[model samples]
Target: MNTFLYDVKTKCPVCGREFTYTKVRMSHLKVLERRKDLYTKYDGIEPFFYDPIVCPNCGYAALSDVFNNISDEGKKEILSKITTNWTKRKFSGKRTPQKALESYLLSLYCSQLKNDKDIIFAKTCLRIAWIYNILNDSSNENRYLKISLDMYKKAYEGFEAYDGEIQLIYMIGELNKILGYRDEALKWFNKVINHPDRKNHSLIVNYAKDEWQSLKI
Candidate 1:
């Protein structure tokens, strides 16, 4: 079947250069399977494999959510640190898993360069870990997962409540469990099960319950 991936026009926030970035049409996506941690495998092209858009003119890359939301300071930083050293490149064609990994890592670097929120860094690192998981590079995958878990922990400690906060807390517990930090995992999981927000987020509540129970067995 033909993959419904196409190019979308984008203006680089850092350099103000027009470029085309590839995206998968969501309506055409076919999910083959979804893993316990919510890693999805698609029948065709993976939509998430194209979640980041990189400006070919400059090296500024970001996840779609933050692509156009750069602050003036962020733009200045990107221009100084990335664009100034960037050579023209293209990421507009069909992307391999490795290419997608490269794009995500670049976005992670850019997020750090711009001093974006811990959530942004955590999300980028999570995606990088997922890519490594797909590649069966368990060492690299776990390394990024550790980084993501730390970032999430920091965000949870310092940030105010936001959308999906319940999910964030659940992820911290789950990541801790995956990393063999059983005590820490149980601590966070206990918090999730007792959190008032858990009532409103039934999905996370159920998942947390399941994980918590499984750990006790």
Candidate 2:
């Protein structure tokens, strides 16, 4: 059963009695045997370690809400709604994570002024690309990755956010590495590592360091 911690102090919903903040633990009474995977857009590729919230002052607080909490049935219903415009009108649309990601990106390529939504969609495409690459789906992975890189390049040219720039370059390096574009990967890795604006993110920095060192050997 999935469990989380919350601040249990508050004016009790049952009775209006305000208590001092106190931490409390709460668990799902029912264990939903759901597949634990990053199956949504905008959630990056990382292992989920729950660091639940606590508000001792409140005595009853919502914890572990960092992750979305939707039951399988609920998620299916939502997905059905999400895909109603483009695909079959069933809750169980058999839409894989990759498909959902691509569909989402496709929907974002509007002729009007693009904003954070378009960039976020590009990130989702990259995530799906990275997943497929890891799963050995080279063809689909490369396709999504190419699209992501194109969008990222556009963002890089258009905006000046350091974090976004670092990510854009880093992802290009990663995809090139997987695709055996060694020189291209090296170029991107060097650009990120040497760029004045790039932050030393754990994911990007560590990967760049390892690959840079390996290339030396």
Candidate 3:
């Protein structure tokens, strides 16, 4: 059986003729429910029916189809994460996804401030960029990463510059990897492991480290 790559739209519903129509891959179709816990359970179309998105042409829809595509476990995981994040943002007063992530990171870094600081904001920015990355929106991805690097610069100010060097290097290495700068990423990873802060929490570059080790470069 072939997988339905796009939304199935029938031309003449009564005749059962396949339609030749342009396809639209809209944003992630989210089904919002009043009961967050119930939705996280991944039971079905929620307590009531809600359309996450609509077709521009024929207006055909099957909300259950979307839910059926992904497994119940996956649905529960995503719904739970959304609920948790939403709860965190409530206290942080960050309604937008962008602000919610930033606020969460800032709260995490609030106590770690030293005469010198860096990496916290960059990590936050990386997380923020993921919101767009998941949606295949390169425009926002690069934009947020650039902003993250700028934040890293600000984070590195007025303190022991070497404290978070490992994490800083890791973040730079990850960025380089994404930007297709393999050599530069390797160099950054090298700098991370050898840096004084290597023992503490770093940007967690295990994949790059493993790959680089295998390459024997």
Return the TM-score for each candidate structure.
0.93, 0.47, 0.39
Task: Give candidate 1 misplaced runs (Cα > 4 Å).
Answer: 160-162
lDDT of each: 0.85, 0.46, 0.42
What is the per-residue lDDT of model 3 for residues 182-203, given as tens digits with 9 covering 90 to 100? 7876786677666665556533
Comparison by TM-score, 1 against 3, better one: 1
- Evaluated at residue 3, the lDDT of candidate 2 is 27
lDDT of 2 by residue, 1-217 (tens): 1123233433422113454322223232333332211122222222111122222222111223311333445334433433234342211122344443443343233111122333554555665665575568889778887776676666666674534577667766766676667888888889878876656566566677677677657
Name the regions of candidate 2 deviating beyond 4 angstroms. 1-118, 130-136, 160-164, 197-203
- What TM-score would you give candidate 3 relative to the actual structure? 0.39
Predictions: Cα RMSD each = 1.7, 12.8, 18.6
What C-alpha lDDT, on a 0 to 100 scale, does residue 205 get in candidate 3? 44
Candidate 1 local Cα displacement, residue 204, angstroms? 1.4
What total of clashing residue pairs does each candidate reach? 0, 11, 4
* Better candidate by TM-score, 1 or 2: 1
Best by TM-score: 1
